[model samples]
Target chain A: MPKPAPHIDILPDVPLRLNRCHEACGPGADAFAFTLAARLNGPVMWISESWTPAQLNPVGYSQYADPAQLLMARTKDQTDTLAVAEEALRAHAVRLVVTELTQPISLLAGRRLQLAAETGQTTALCLIPQGMGSNAADTRWRCTPVFHQADSTQARWEIIKNKAGTLSAWDVRWDEKTRHMLVVPPAGNRPGLADASG
Target chain B: MRPVDGPFALTLHEANTDRIYCLNDPAEGQGLSQGMGLADARAFCPDLQSRPADPAADARFLRILARWAKRYCPWVGLDGRDGLALDITGAAHLYGGEAALLEDLHARLTRAGLQVRSGLADTKGAAWAIAHYARGVAPPGQTRNHIAKLPVPALRLPEDTVTALQRLGLRTVDDILTLPRATLTRRFGTDLLMRLDQALGDQPEEVSPLPDPPSFAAQMSLPEPIGLAADVMAGTERLLAQVCTRLTQQEAGARALLLTLRRVDQASQQVELRLARPLRDAARILPLFERGVSAVDAGFGIDQLRLEATQVERLPARQLSPLHAAHQDKLHDLITRIGSRIGLDNVHRYLPADSHIPERSYTTAVAAYSDPSGAWVTLRPRPIRLFPPEPIAATGHRPPRHFRWRRMSLSTARITGPERIAPEWWLQDDSWRSGLRDYWQVDTRQGRRLWMYHTPQTPGWYVQGEFA
Candidate 1:
């Protein structure tokens, strides 16, 4: 088995699927994405659809990753978006290739992307909306915004599925001073809810 | 040459008419004038040989000759179909003098089996007149003296104007020049006066030379016509190599290249390639022409191939680390391939803008031209993506507990307080007319995260963006 990379502690050396629990959890996923991309060695390629209203703002993203090392492609459709991501992975230049799809991808497409990532020794992340169909991804993570305190940057991430069959969760807070995500322990030893029951 | 030779005086038949468009010097010597009826010409020179006139071939040959004349002077103009005008202003001293330049030009062309006549004068009009009417170089400042003896037709006036002047017994330029300027203008109109003044150097006439077509172009004429794709590719590779060499020497790269194939059947085909980034490497540029080259019909067979860089740009010096440089090159190559497949307009990159407003904080620019710069001010949380503010049906002055958005009735699970973002009053934005906004991060029961803001002035709540 391939060991997980030092900085990328969430999954092994394989492509990961990030499923957004809500429409508003996009920022949290992007925050984790940039953190993961920053640890990689080479440049990054971000592919998205042209109709996507919210794009990766370089100004905001640059805070986490080197903006100069980032390349973007706005594809016309979902197929082109996935193709671009796959091509970027196979190019062996980008350390990470991120793509967002309006609809869920097929198992074949997911396997193809995974194969390309393994061949190029690169990481791939597919950002999809909630309740999408399953694919052959190594790990599936669902990120949701945790609204505990006002003006707090906290997110709850649940590893719903993993290739190793291990399930875990974390209440992650973005530490502005350290510029790294800190895993917050459960409060008062109370049993932590698997889902946001607010 | 065959058309001009034979046992008869040769004349060319006009394409659309039965009249004689032009006649060889031998036929002209036999009293066969141009624009004469074919029957009349046949009668005048009982053994008159006639062939159809090809104006396209004539124009093409003239253009080629004009290009060849560039060896003498940078500025060469095609004077009519059979004549060439060269502005050898400062280039006269290179070949001894003005007289020697004309002699060399005439002698070289005559040796090339061409009946060449050249004239040198201060003005283009006088030079043209001397070239056709008199076959020698005219002394500088003696244009008036030299052209005075030439006929009125030598002034390049309209045929009707020349005939009208001839009717008035003004058969020569001297006759018109001797006449009073007012009478000449009144009788023959301002055209006659303008032509007379232009020839006599009284009025400045700008001889606008034809635009030198392509700055970087290489051409090869094969001994035999090549119909095979491999032969055409070989020819193209040679041209590309030559052009790329020149580009490298000049420290420039071509942004667009044009390949013209002249077939033996007189039909020409062109293939054009537009590049995303300027490039000079022939090895890299050759494969790009495969699609374009194969698309060329190559009707009959191509006898001539010309490669030209229609658009060029100065290549910036690369100053990156070795590792990063290789990655950058690969990225650039990938972008170029994708851009060539789709289009450069489809590739975009975001650049930070100097604005505090959420929507105005960034701008989109073509990826080829922009590089990421500056730091993102993340003093407060900003959504990964922002949309046009959609009004939400909510009933509350404070943050609403439940709202209807996108046809979904959802209850707010938790609400973060209104982060008041005041409008920038200095700038007039139509969307911000509501003055002040109090934003809240709303988490709904349906696991949907939304960034909604309450416009105090407009007294309404709207969904501005969504968290990832």
Candidate 2:
């Protein structure tokens, strides 16, 4: 008799949110990603062409359940850059990988990264805004800023993504003076991702 | 120590890159403003002193302030150009409530001859806003209301952002408060919202609490900077002794070290060393530094010497074996003696590579600090010497039995295997440009066994390694 394969909870295939970097996303995209990484607790990676210390200047790694590791390629356009990033992800047991690239990813590279993420049950958030072509992406997100009509001191972050079920589009109001993010009006009562109806 | 109310403060100012500009007046008649022209300032006050800014001096002063600030609160950070931020949350009660805390701080700073403005709030963002905007200083309870009256600059928005807001006909905090939140984000970006959020205490902003002094660092401040190699060695010896004592006290050993030399001319020279194993004795550490210091070309005198143990491990407290004890002592002695003479970094140990690539099987890491030999416990069947990629004149798919290596023509006596090794498809390594390689162990006529490989895709053979 053949040995039975171990029952595993494979990660479900989720749509990839694609956007052209620097266009749909601004300079603050890196900061936003970093903040999310902190909130997520563990398993986040930031991949980019040109990296400055400012991008990685969050709370130190010792604070996390797993130490935060930053990996880089000597050159951006080099084909081996993705490989290096993959190695880092495997080595560090990263849960999420964020990339900032000037060019769009190839279909093969996207498939490879997706497979790795599925195998590891990791989430990869690729920031590609307008202008760059899609590479077999699972989903696409368009992030834009919006201010509140009642109070100018607050602003709203509108996240429009294709794969977010009924919650594909949502807005969260943020106070400019307090640096606080608040849900506006009726939507404010719902929890994060609560509106997503699969 | 002087009373907290009356600590002496010294202010040093510099003009451009040269000249010293200092004002000893504690009564606010220094005749200088940030944007005032140099010529005009001089004309405004004839006795005004001017000197070029010495950033090194400013850094040194900050370090001093850091040490002194510990007397009040352990958490202190240098806040921009000429300010320090202290998190006096829990520590304030020691001096009494907020009022007494400020009084104590004021007294100490005044005595130190430093001008200070302090603001207390629930958040660092709020505190920062209050400190820069409110009159005198935002009293603790009314921090938010007080900040509202201050100019938009108090929000700490970038100059361009502030200018854009002004152009939008939004003059005050009240004016912006009436506008819609979505409108602000669409026009200004999230940063505007973030700043506003910070002011209203909606988000938490943490001050990186100053860390307690570590036991692994050794520092020496010279009366005058020393430029010669021997002078540097003398300072290094003192620092090593201190660090060794610290390591011994903690029952820990250092495996990696950084030797920092700050030049009198404001330049810095650094040397790093890694060891095969952790070591605590100064005798072992001093020698490695001798070669290291000589390598540092001190363009100017070195004013400070800082030695830091970058990596450390717990030292096992076990009795030394009679046989290995002497050997261990001798090995350590030799390492230290050689370090003193040739410098520490020149010595190295082999560390196992994390990759499967033959050329990457081992790498050179700093001796004395890394477990290089320990990384590879079981030895694989590897050649004693591996040559860098060498070109051969072979044209066929099969590796030629006779090939030239380093101007010598050698014929193969015995050949073993075409071990097919494929390049990682996902990765593009330049060395892998030859694509699939078929490695072979060939015994040559010169009694020299060689490791040769033929790239089937590229159709060529190359000598990769030699056997002992």
Candidate 3:
């Protein structure tokens, strides 16, 4: 068994173990990672594959975090993207690093990134379209756009596994005016959500 | 000692006539002069043996001789097609003096079977004229007096200009110098005076020397074959140290280093490392080589190693780089380490561009080459991921309509008002050719907020972005 590393937090409830890698897979995974990046201080690095046919819109990213603090590394291959993300984390040049992968990486590659992130004290997030089934990551997140009831605009982030053992799930909304993620109370009548288009 | 038993001449066809381009000393003595017709030269010397001239071979030979003359001085230029120009200003003292230097050059070339003429002067024009006409070293500051008696052709003017001056009896530099300066310019243009001024040291004539290109490479062979990765890395480190020392001596930094390994079976393997910036530090370079060193397979015990700085740039010492130097170094190191895996060009940042269109609001600039500038100010609601528009199948233009996207069909639970975006009339965009768009931020029942647009001109709906 590999050694356990301390978890780090980008937001309040999302305490992702540091030196270890966590992942958010399936639909809306990148958006969940971007929400965490908004809370991180210092520089951030993002890695994506070149032929993915999708573009990152900085206009929406600016609403979450300062795009100026973000550095992007686009690789030709999926393996190279993860490898570059590992090196970026190992360099400890940034506080957080995000990687956009077409598919989930293997447990060995994930563990390699975990060790590298631990060495540099960087939190790495691998956002893939498919879930990481039975991987060695610290946690596996599934954050999707959900409303409390009708006409509500909030996101539901559910943690399928947490090595650090935090909350099971949390509901939050991106507050545009304050530029922070406001956690909605789970116990009661919900705060009526504003129009998501704003 | 001659290839021909008698006088020899090399003639070339020029201006529709076979003219004598060059001749040996014996041919000159037999009145078979340069530019003379072959028949006329044969009449002058019945035993004349001649062949065609090769100007291209002569020019190549001249360049070779110029390179050889670099032993006298680092600055050497080709004077026309036949002469050599040596700028032995400070270099002459090494061979005793200017006259001694000329004598040594002339003696060494003469021993090589060349009838070489030597000259020593302060300027290229004076030296070339002396080598052709005077054939000896002339005293400094006495160029005007020395070349005053030489023919006007020694000034290196066009043949027509020289002939025109000769027809007017301005046969020597002294004749032209003695005339009114304005009258000379009026008669022969500035070229004649420019040459005379260059000879008399009134105008500076720079000798653009042929530079010997510098090579940054090092190679070493092992005493015995060792197939271990440690042994290969050890060899690589040693080679890198040697190359770095040489690079330090030249004040240069390597942007890319190529390390090649040779095995006992005569197979070669290469590991290349590219950097985001020029680097020369051996300690900093050793770790970078570590990443690529393991990838090379040491087939059948490697026996030789070579490291070469394939791309290099100048990196001078900085005096006031003390502040934030450590911070900048770590960032650069990170960029380089990541850049090596993904290409250096792939590492970049998105800088905000002033545009009303959602897609054109930001431009990705390679991080190493640019500075972080411009604050991203989002004017309206935009999605996090904005790919090219994928057509959506809908019944009506209003909200609550069902559409299939990415293998999923979902109905809109909530819809916002259509925010109209018109095409910039001055710009040409093929995507916006369908005309003005009425965008609707729709929250689907399937827990997805999609940015949908209706092209008013075509009256079709399409999904473009995700607000998730």
User: Which CAPRI quality tier does the interface of model 3 achieve?
Assistant: medium
Error of 1 at A55 (Å): 3.6
lDDT of 1 by residue, B1-468 (tens): 543573243346556447877666778788777778888777777878877677788899888888888888888878787788899999989999998888888888888878787788888889888988997878888888999999989999998998888988988889987888898778778988887777778888775677754358999999999988888999999999999988887789998899999999888999888776788989978877776788789878999999999989998655657656666666766676556545666777667777778888877778776666765566666766578889987756676877788887878878777788888888989999988888887877665678899988879889987764
lDDT of 2 by residue, B88-184 (tens): 7688778777777777777888998786677777667767766766524455666567666666777789999999998888877767777899999
Better of 1 and 3 by TM-score: 3
Q: Give me candidate 1's TM-score against the actual structure.
A: 0.61
Give a tens-digit lDDT track for model 1, residues A89-169.
776767788777788778888888878877776778777776553456766667766665332556777777676457777
lDDT of 3 by residue, B232-306 (tens): 888888888888888888899999999988989999999998877788888888888777887778877888888
Candidate scoring better on lDDT of 1 and 3: 3
True interface contacts retained by model 1: 0.37
By DockQ, who's the top model here? 3
Q: Rank order by DockQ, top first? A: 3, 1, 2
Docking outcome class, model 1: acceptable
* iRMSD for each candidate structure, in the order shown: 3.1, 26.5, 1.7
Judged by DockQ relative to the true structure, which candidate is superior, 1 or 2?
1
Q: How many pairs in model 2 have backbone atoms within 3 A of each other, for residues 3 or more apart or on separate chains, i.e. clashes? A: 74
How much lDDT does candidate 2 score? 0.58
lDDT tens digits, residue span A127-186, model 3: 866655337777888888884344334787788877767648777777767666667777
lDDT of each: 0.75, 0.58, 0.81
Deviation in Å, model 1, residue B316 alpha carbon: 5.7
